[model samples]
Target: MSRPGQSSRLLICCTALIVCQFVSQLSQAGVIRDKLMERRAQQSEMEEEEAATNGPRFKLPPGTRVLEDVAYGSDAKQKMDVYLPASAGDHSAVRLPVIFMVHGGAWAIGSKTHNKVVENKVARWLPKGFIFISINYRMLPQLLAREQAEDVARALAMAQSKAAEWGGDPDQFIIMGHSAGAHLISLLSTSPDMVAQFGVHPWLGSVSLDSAAYDIPAIMATKHYGFYDKAFGTDPAYWRRSSPLHALNTAGAPFLAVCSSKRPDHPCDQADYFVKRANAIGMRASVLPQARSHGDINQQLGLENSYTQAVEDFMASLSPAIRRHLE
Candidate 1:
């Protein structure tokens, strides 16, 4: 029981185990470092990929093609592309009223140019004297959802600065987005704090959203969007701070929220919620139910989805003269 040689051997074995543990820790750290590097590289690649794609191209008035380059704000989200209409004077009837369109990608991935229904033949509306402007904004992981809302505010402000130049009336600003972008529009519509920061009055009109997220708390409560935890993390306060339903009021402007079905239990529950509350106040609100999936509701924009009629009807109802003055 007191053999000196045996004691030395046992000590050596213990030391070896410690050394092995240290080595394993080092390997794990290296793997983590490598993965982070890979992820950063992939994100860089994605930005370049988005940059390489030419934004929407159009035939400007008087047979001129003009691609406008605008420097929006401090962040890169301050960028946008303007498609001018052919031969119409600044604020002319033919110059096409501008619709500040935002794209959908769960507030993570999307480019304004990437979602051009007018470019694609799925449904044609460019000839309707409409000028479509899609803009990019900071997304989650890189920025908070609130910060992304700031980017939208900046985009609209920047548009306002050049309203006369683009023949767009400052009062006729039309805000629209899909999915998270729609959430963003709703957020901006309701959040007076965010709107006042833009240094302008509220906008004129809105057109179309498909299965957009309206209530942040309600959506997070679902806890089944596959990326909910990753997006906002598991913080309850964070969810409450970002929900649009919490901030929305009758003071918000008139807009339409569309869903796949008129029923309350549809997957796009936010649209239903918006319709219900909006109608309670006698606000000029409307909802056109569709039996399409979330993705189908959105991608259906350039296609033969039933949502087209709603968009057409809504747009047609707008006073053309008033739309022209939207900045």
Candidate 2:
């Protein structure tokens, strides 16, 4: 017979062996799972990249027309896609309002074809009787924020010149942009001189879709993320010069500043501050606070939600006839 202490030691040894085996198996399984997940993530990214390059996959509504790669300038990046709404008999007789879209990628890398978020907006609004024009601008590192704004202005001028050909009203242009694009449009709307300088017909109003840097000086003063460094850079004077808040003295078109209420320093805080400043300066401005991510604030605008309704309401305020036609 074995001694009690010896038997206890034997049992403990067996238990330890069993535990070791189980742990080894678990470790192997975890490695396999991680590898599989990584592969899946890579595949998904590849698919998204392909889709963005190819443009919107979904077919447009009947009678809607899309003019792709229309050159607004000499550079390859100075291209835009115009979507014209269908009309009854004579398309030229029906003058539609233009929604000039600007895509956002921190003002560095984005394209009219690559930003798929605007695709849904195109689908939703084109059938509703609005001519949508999604544009691309020269990016950062090579071109600063001010230059990018100038590029947008030039593109607007080009689009305005070609608006009548596509059954769009040159005078009824409404600027809409997300994030960095929002910042650019906000700059144009507040600084009437910039619009005047561009020599494009005056825009009816603008919809700023969740831009955080309305007040660049304030942003530079706070603890901002690393991206702002590349966009705004280390210059205080440039910050003020590019700032919409700093350029808000001139009363221009009405503005609907939509922002995400989630972020602490932006959209919520910055948007409200911007609107207050604009109102103080006698410019008609309104603040829209949405509980969404920065990107979602742009992507979900034309969807069937209160957010979409709010945007529609703002557009209606710009032109009641446009709203009537949609209805």
Candidate 3:
């Protein structure tokens, strides 16, 4: 109904409107993405700050004392914090059992003093006259997974050497860790000779919390996170060297592998496989499946619940003295 010039003018206006709308949508999407990134950055900062400064959230039982930054190696990260009960002193004859803890952050990040690492655990165990030790180790880009295990061994040796000074038993240590820490303790349990080389005596047992990396070669064979590759690398030989399942040859110590039933990765299945092998070789080993998330498996362990009770039962089985403390 219009002349050519008028029709052409109408078409240009329509195209301009469509283009403007598209640009507006793109701008909105960019803004949303920017906001999301900003929120994530803020959250990361908050977590770092908390990990740096936060202590146990619960009140310390009366007379509980802490010795911070007890160095095992020359590196600053190779330090541990020792928590002592009121009963622990040079003058006291009572020798407390030790719980040596390793924190988990994919083998790359985490601290000894993170609230989740020490809060409920310190509250529960210190009151029971247990000596709780939380350690920090050199992490990824600085040390490989195998090297980290060595750091753990070094820390154990140091803790054992100083046990009497802190009113703890040198032979009654229970090595416990969560996530990547779990993987490290599992590796050491499987390779007792490696720990022995570091002058560490035999520990009582090990408790591994929600570790899926027991079989490194198996994990690398399937779909996995990029972090695993970063930690284990591309060599199958290195995978075997780092794998707990592959490294396990002889009986070392009693073990408890606690796994999360909620993860799609089937951590329980891996735990079961490791336990089966351990039991076959005249070792006391078991897998406990819990309906907890990966983080909760570590965070909720020392809380007054069935989970804590079960762990304490395992501790009791280690020795009569430990049983008495739990009682």
Q: Which candidate is the best by lDDT?
A: 3
Model 1: lDDT equals 0.62
lDDT comparison, 1 vs 3, better candidate: 3
Better of 1 and 2 by lDDT: 2
lDDT of 2 by residue, 76-134 (tens): 77888888777622445767788999887777777786545466787788887788898
Badly placed stretches (over 4 Å) of model 2 are 1-54, 88-92
Question: Candidate 3 local accuracy as lDDT?
Answer: 0.87
The lDDT per prediction is: 0.62, 0.79, 0.87
Worst 10 residues of 2 by lDDT: 42-51
Q: lDDT tens digits, residues 95-160, model 3?
A: 999999998877778889887778889889988989999999998889989889999999999999
**Any runs in candidate 1 off by more than 4 Å, and if so which?**
1-52, 57-69, 90-96, 115-123, 261-265, 302-306, 320-327
Clashing pairs in 3: none
**In model 2, which residue pairs have backbone atoms overlapping below 3 Å?**
none
Model 3 spans > 4 angstroms off: 1-50, 54-58
Instruction: Tell me the lDDT of model 3 at 190.
Output: 95
